[model samples]
Target chain A: MKVRVSVQLKPGILDPQGKAVEQGLHGFGFAVEHVRIGRLIEMDVPGADAAEVKARAQAMCDKLLVNPVMEKASIEVL
Target chain B: MRVAVPVFPGSNCDHDALHACGTVMGWDTIPVWHQEPRLPAGTDLVFIPGGFSYGDYLRCGAIAALAPVMADVKRHADQGGLVLGVCNGFQILCEAQLLPGALLRNASLRFIHADVHLRVERADLPFTSALKAGEVFQVPIAHAEGNFTLEPGDLADLEARGGVAFRYCSPKGEIGEAFVPNGAMNGIAGIVNVRGNVLGMMPHPERVVDPRLGPTGGLGIFRSLAAALARG
Candidate 1:
């Protein structure tokens, strides 16, 4: 199974990279706002089924993929 | 005073830290590998130095915080032993949940490399025992993720508990957003753990601790630690 983990800063946390990108968009005459920057981690996992794969991915997030203090993560198993 | 500095694969300041502790301060300081399950025997202090540990793959200090030697550091901290983290070390302390807040990127989205003034908030703690509250000192800060962040409630609690050890300030001791190098909350430069035995700060005191290297403003930290440990 192919798994993807998307990590983003929590809603209330400040994202300086996001803000800078937003400013760059504005300078380029593009009408964009609330531009947030995040990271994506893709991996291959072997499991009995999709359910098990997702469970395994979520466990990874809980263990190290996500930092509850500043980041939130979503896992997609494909 | 005995200091143990754990050397991660990408650590670049282990020598500086060891030099400051072992040479300048004439203390028993040794470098322990990250893979080591335990720190040097009878470790009195664990000083995590600055560097791009584990290549900062996941987060600044996320990977290094989970190194094998960290478990013993946690145990040592819980037992009221001293721990001081500088720059990348600060990030590790936060990532390890030994400190209260997380260090975010600079507000300008730049890697700041400059000397900034810091105002000592309280002199009663072990980390600042040789200094005086309201005293100002100059130290160099070089890191992109030094802007500290935490939930408002937690920030307030930390402030009320006197956990803030140093706040960025002007040469004359004026503190506010204007003096802050990174957009840290309340212009905080350093903070201590709840028990006051652990300290995490973005500035590189080891770099400027030597008197020959200009102002020895950073010397107070090592001196304070030596005094505090001696008193015990």
Candidate 2:
């Protein structure tokens, strides 16, 4: 199965890179209120079903895929 | 006192640290490879110096934090041995959970490199014993993700316990927004572990030991460590 993990900095944590991108968009005459960046990581996992794949991806997040201190993540099985 | 510096694959500052502790300070220092399962005998301090470990893959220090020798490093800390980490070394400690908090991207969205002033928060621990509380010293910091962050409750708890070892400050010792180089929380430059035996900071103290090179603010750090370990 192919699993996708979308990781993002939690709200209230400043995202300077996102801010820079936002500024760039504004320069192009786009009226964007705010912008935040998230990382998309896709991986292939062996599993019997979607539920099992989700659980396994979540385990990866628990171990090293996501840092509990500063980032949050969402998992999807494809 | 004996010092052990763990050298990771991308650890560029290992030799600099070894030079400061071995050649300059005249202390017995050895570089321990990351594959070694154990530190050399009679190691008084484990100094993890700065560099883009593992090419800063995934995140700074995240990969190196899981290197083979880290179990021994954690054991050394668990046994209450003194440990000091600088720059990327600091990131490794945080990633390894040897220290609290995470170092995020600099708010400026750029790599910052400059000498900055740091205020000593307290001098009671082995790491800062040579300096007085509120003393301001200059040290060079070079990094893109030196912004330190922690959960609100944990941050307050760490503050209340005096876990903050140093803060970005003016030359006259004023800590505030203007002095912050990396946008770290509360202008923190360094922090100590709950046990007070481990310290991790972004600034490179080993770089400024020689007067011919630059500022001598970092002299106190090595002096304090050596003095504290020598007394016992």
Candidate 3:
């Protein structure tokens, strides 16, 4: 199974990288309101059941892939 | 005092830390590899030096926090042993949950490398005992994710417990928005655990211990550690 995890800073936490990206977009003449930078992680897991794979992916996010205090993570099973 | 300085794969300041503790301070210092599951039997202080541990791959200090040595570090900290985490080590301590809060990217979105003034917020703690409260000192800070962030309630709790060890301040010791270098909340530059044994700070004290290299303002921190160990 293939799993994708997206991690993002929680709302209200300052996102300096996102802000810099937004500024760069404005400088390039793009109509951008706001942007929040995040990370995407792809992994391969050996599992036949989709539900079991999703559960394991979620566990990985909770344990190591994401820091709960500052970021939130969502897992997608492909 | 017996000092154990752990060296991770990318730890650059381990030698500086060892030199400060062993050569300069004349303490029995040993370099412990990150793969070791336990520290020396009589380790009194565990110093985690600054660097891009694990190449800062997942996050700053994220992978280093899970190294085998950290399990022993936690056990040592739980037993009231002294642990000092500098810069990237500070980030690892937070990641290990030995310290509160997380170090976020600098608000300026750039790496800050400069000597900044800091105020000794609590001189009575084990880490700052050699200095007096409100005293100003210059220390070098080199990091991209040195901005410390915590929940409002947690911040209140930390302050109420006197965990704040150092705060960014002016040369004259006045703390204000103008003095904050990396946008740390409440100007916090360093903090101690609830027991006051473990300290984590973004500033590099070991880098400033020798006057030949730079200002010796940071020597007081190492002296304080030595004094604390001597009394025990």
Candidate 4:
């Protein structure tokens, strides 16, 4: 099974990378109004159970990958 | 007084912290490697210095938080030993859950490297006791990720309990917005734990130990700790 975990800084948690992207878009004369930078983690597991993969990936995020206080993480099994 | 500065992989400021301890405060500062499971005997203070620990791989201070040395640091803190973390050291303490909140990237998205103005918010802890409340000092900050964020309830509790040690300030005496070099919520530059022994601050107090190079903001911090140790 393949699992993908997407993590993003929560609202009210300042996102500097996103702000820079917004500024860059304005500088390039583009109409893009907003951009939010998030992290994506892709991993492969031998098991075929989607539920287990998601649970395990979520655990990985909570324990190591993401800081729960300032960021939210979602895991998708594929 | 004996001081221990834990050195993690990529920790470049352990020597700076050690130098500050020995040269400025006249304590025998010992540099402890990250793999040590126990701190040195009769250590008065434990300092986690700034650097890109673990290359800041998963997140800043994430890997170092789980290092063997932290177990000893946690034990020392539980026993009321003074623990001071500066810059990446602050991130390590937060990641270790010794302090609340998380430090995110700067709001401007640029590596901010400047002598910032800081208003001392507390005058009791071993880290900030030397400065009076509302006193402004120049301390240089150099970090890509240094924005401090906390929940509203936590911020209120911190302020009410004198846990908020320092705040980012402008030369004009304003806080938040332009005064905050990074978009740190409420301009919180430093904080102490509920016990007031564990201190986590983004500013590098170890960098300004001498007046010839810059302002002497760093001296107050070391002096505060050394004085506290002597009183014990």
Cα shift from native, residue B153, model 3 (Å): 2.2
Runs off by more than 4 Å, candidate 3? none
In angstroms, what RMSD does candidate 2 have relative to the true structure? 1.1
- In order of appearance, the predictions have TM-scores of 0.97, 0.97, 0.97, 0.92
Collision pairs in model 3 = none
Each candidate's DockQ? 0.79, 0.85, 0.78, 0.69
Winner on DockQ between 1 and 2 is 2
Residues B93-205 of candidate 4: C-alpha lDDT, one tens digit per residue: 99999999888888777888888988888887777777787888888999988988887788788788878888899874567777888788788899999999999999898
Evaluate residue A65 in candidate 4 and report its C-alpha lDDT on the 0 to 100 scale.
88
Kindly report which residue stretches of model 2 are placed more than 4 angstroms away from their true locations once superposed. Answer: none
Task: Please report the TM-score between candidate 2 and the true structure.
Answer: 0.97
Which CAPRI level is candidate 1? medium
lDDT of 2 by residue, B139-229 (tens): 9999999999998998998899999999999889997899999889999899999889999999999998877766788999989998899
lDDT of 3 at B32: 95
Docking quality of model 2: it rates as: high
For candidate 4, the per-residue lDDT at B77 reads 94
Those runs of model 4 whose alpha carbons end farther than 4 Å from true positions after fitting are A26-31, A46-48, B171-176, B211-214
Residue B102 Cα positional deviation in candidate 2, in Å, after optimal superposition = 0.8
